[model samples]
Target: MRLSRRLEKLPPYLFVEISRKIAEKRAQGIRVVSFAIGDPDLPTPPHILDALVEASRDPANHRYPETEGLPELRQAIARWYRRRFGVELDPDTEVLPLIGSKEGIGHVAFCLIDPGDIALVPDPGYPVYPMGTVLAGGEPYYLPLREENGFLPDLDEVPAEVARRAKVLWLNYPNNPTGAVADLDFFRRAVEFARRYDLAICHDGPYTEVAFDGYRPPSFLQAEGAKEVGIEFHSLSKSYNMTGWRIGMAVGNAELIRALRDVKSNLDSGIPQAIQLMAIAALDGPQDCIDEHNRVYQRRRDRLVEALRSLGLRVNPSPASLYLWARVPEGETSVSYTTKLLEEAAVVVTPGVGYGPSGEGYIRLSLTLPDDDLEEGLRRLEAIAHGRPVRL
Candidate 1:
């Protein structure tokens, strides 16, 4: 069967490949401990679930929703930013509900980018960012994110020729896979760069509320002049343990929101009204839930980092997000290292090369397992490091 030329150009997802291997192991009856996917293991808070149940009973919820989103949800999202980041937003014009931030990330590319245009994307970044650009018929120019730059792309280093042709730039803080947080000064510089280059900045900020150790990740709009060139995506998936709920918001620049809404209206129907109600509950409710969630993740982060260090792998303690990015031992490619771990240790982790070429020789382990499961995974890793083999 022949696929569309556009679809054929896309790279297969490495995480999905890992998942297939996991499935094969499961088929063989192995109790494989998984640290590959960044999915929260915690259940959604009961109060938010109750809100969904209540909304589900309402007759109005059974109907199709507004593509732009429920007014109540948008207003709640707006209030969240104002309270947390001191960035005031017009709920009516600046906020658009997303199926999840991923959908917004993908569709926003199609909305803003034209064929043959260029987009500045971070290497070792979330796959969706660059993949979206490709699927939208735009060329992607990867800015290699290195430890020397603190894993943040240096906009000034991008050649002027590349900058002039770029229509969009995708950025994430408290980043996926790496867990590197960006500061306000960095965001200000990014906004300045975008304005100077006449490019739109899409800030994917799903992990802001999941930060630890007094680390507060700021909204891009908190930077001066950001509203003129930036749009930020937020999701309840990470902070509220609501990944399956599929509700998120894109807020900033009224023009960007309108373009997103117009594109969204053509693609599909809105998120379920019931889910929107629950998302509102998540935003407006007491944020003690966030604190508790962060506490759990912090414990796992500390435990995993210690465990990896014991296995002779140097891993930096993550300041935020659910991943521990660690380099594979000397003389092993990331793919070979991960394959050996899976087959011998019965432990699964994401190979860094799956993210991009710059990620070679590294691996990402997700701290999304229960305490017992995490300990067991670490034990398996230790055994593997000691040159012992285990049956899967």
Candidate 2:
């Protein structure tokens, strides 16, 4: 079948490939222990779920939702930002609801990128970032998120010509796949860079609430001068175990927010009213679930890190997010190691190369599974590491 040039430029969505491999293993009757995707296994808190049920039952909510979002829900998101980050937002103009941060990210890119423009994207970052640029006919300039840089992009290293031509700079902290947390200083530098480059700064912050060690991730808007140059995407998925709820918020620069909303308005309907109400409850209600969720993820992170280390894999447990980014064992590429783990041990993990070229010899394991399932996955990994022939 013939495809559009833009469609051909895109690679297979990362998780889709992982899911396919997992399904293939399942078809062969293997009970694969998956640590690939970051979809939380925890159920949504009852309060949020109840809010959804109540809203869904109301006839008033049956009609089309406001494309900008329900005002009350936007206010709830604004309140969340104010309370957590000390960044006051004009919810009416500065905040917009998303069908998860993923969708908002693409829309933001499309809003800013013209055909053949440049976009600065993190290597080993979320696939959506580069894909959005590609779909918009923009060229992606990958900034290596190396260990020496503490996994933050070194803006000065960006080519002067590329920086001048770029229309968007995409960033995320407590990042997907890598789990690298960005500090306020990093955001400050990023804001300054974007200001100088005159590009839109798009920060995806879905894992902000899923942090540990008493570490709360800050929003990009919290940085001095950040609101002048950037917008942040916040998701309820990780924070409230509301992955299927499809509610998120875009906040920061009012202009950027409006631009993204304009793009979204043309392409999609706003979030469902029931889900919007549920998001309100999730945000404005008690944040105890966030702390409790992080606690569980911390335990799983520590356990999995220890288990991987015991098998001589070099892994650092991230203080934020549900990922353990580890170097592949020497002598094997990311694909080779990940493929071996899947076929021989029935252990599923994401290959780092799927993230970018810089991720060549690394692998990412998500800590989103239950304790027992995670333990079983660790045991399988250990068995493979010990060079044992397989038997479940």
For all predicted structures, in order, the TM-scores are: 0.98, 0.98
Candidate 2 Cα errors over 4 Å, as ranges: none
Residue-by-residue lDDT tens digits, candidate 1, 1-392: 98779988788877788889999998998899999998899999999999999999999999999999999999999999999999999999999999999899999998878999999998898999888999999999998889878899988899999999999888898888788888889999998899899999999999888887878888888999888998999999998999988888899999999999999999989999999999999999988998998889998898888878888897899898888899999989999999988988789999898998889888999988888888888878887888876644
lDDT of 1 at 261: 96
Of candidate 2, the 10-residue stretch with the lowest lDDT total is: 383-392
Q: What is the lDDT of candidate 1?
A: 0.90
- List the candidate 1 regions with Cα displacement exceeding 4 Å: none
Candidate 1 positional error at 244, Å: 0.8
